[model samples]
Target: MYRSLLLGLAGNSAAEALALRYGMRLGASRFVAGTTLGEALAAVKALNGKGIAVTLDHLGEGIRHLDEADGYMGAYLSLLQAMNREAVNGNVSLKPTQMGLALDPVSALDRIRAIVREAELHSLFVRLDMENSPYTTATIELVRQLHREGFSRVGTVIQAYLYRSAVDVKRLTVERINLRLVKGAYKESSSIAFAKRDDVDSNFKRLIKIRLDSGVYTGIATHDETIIDWTRSYAHRRSIPRSAYEFQMLYGIRTPLQESLAREGYTVRCYVPYGERWYPYFVRRLAERPANAAFVLRNMGRRE
Candidate 1:
């Protein structure tokens, strides 16, 4: 129930406004790097210093106008340029809706294409983050379009909680498109997603095995230690080299675990998010784990 409440608040505009007014003082700073690209880059540098890679996310979505999409496109272009100029060991991640997918799919595709083109020039990978069920098909199709147009440096995420992910994973792997497998953070209907944690974890393991066996590079994005251990054991049993896959985790959720994996000579990447539109992302992070919400409430009385 607590998780559902936080997920519900993720789409509440009034709650978003109140959270924005309070800014990072409400404890969003723990998850969100900051509201600017510069801050995000700095965080990336720090993570890189620790032998961990990063995927920078400029947090904004559900735009109400095409102009906002243009602005986001420009910001992403600038972000790509900055990462290259700074020589950071990181790539970029973006939501399809943030590029106007919700308003017009065609326009959103053009915007995303431009960003992918820019990224290709820098030899950087761009990840199309999967939002909710409503946009899943469109997001995957957009990646397909980009791939067909010769933008091979692009890929999209897959949510294990979804029933359709197994098919999506197989097809995309056959296409040789790199993927980041996440357990999923958004609240999805039980009809389309696995409601029980055990089921989700089981499916997550199944998807991981599928990708690992395919011999294609995959990003196993999860914070579960048990899953991590299982992945290590399975990969060892299969003799899959560490270079074939990387472990991914959120920026603030599990610092020690991330660094520990890195120390073990395994590739670890952190999904670092920034930008002013952080309320939604922040709420989703809380929804993923009750401990996160408790941390926020415990610190709500403290000054930032």
Candidate 2:
């Protein structure tokens, strides 16, 4: 129900206006560091200087124009070069739909190849942001093809909510695919995904255990304390080192926890998103934890 409502509003002009108004005030503190590359660079630099790694995301999804996504790919390549020069322990994250996959997968893949080539120059990595079910197959295919082309620096995300995530994990393991596993953020159908949080978390633990066993450099992306603690304990019992994999969390969702984890000898990467098309991302974040929206509204008047 909530997912349907959000997908419905994703195209609403008026809802976008309202979201923008609320977002402009709340985004600063909630998650988005800025709408520009320079601002993102500063944010990543500050975090990396403190020994905290980062994953910089050029936030805009469900793109309609091939030209727009082409431009997005170019921007990401540029950012990759900057992060290399800045030595910011960071990489770029991207959405296929935002990269012309919605317009044309061929063009999107071509553009992604260019971006990945640029990343290769800097020895930086790219995390292909997974979207809703509609694009999951194409996203996986793109990542697999890129890996085949020797772009090992690129990775993709898998959502535990999906029934096929375990299958995907197994396939990725067979192919030596690096993955970042997240508890599905988008509301999905019970037929296709775990509807309850507990079910999803249970699936998450299973996947984490499998990834750890595979010795693949999987990213455990979650803010749930239980998942984190379980990962820590399982790693310990299995004799998995902290450096074997990494921890990733969305920016602003768990700021202190990210830093704390980094300080505790874990590789922590903050998912820093930026760009003008932050409406859907912002709205979903609100829906995930209504308290976040309330907190944003309650403190919209404060200075950063």
Best by lDDT: 1
Tens-place lDDT digits, model 2, residues 164-241: 999999999889988999998776778899888788899999999999998989899999988899999999999998
Residue 130 error for model 1, in Å? 0.3
lDDT of 1 by residue, 98-195 (tens): 99999999999999999999999999999999999999999999999999998999999999999999999999999989999999888888999999
Error of 2 at 166 (Å): 0.3
lDDT of candidates 1 onward, in order: 0.94, 0.85
The C-alpha local distance difference test score for the whole of candidate 2 amounts to 0.85
Model 1 regions lying over 4 Å from their true place: none
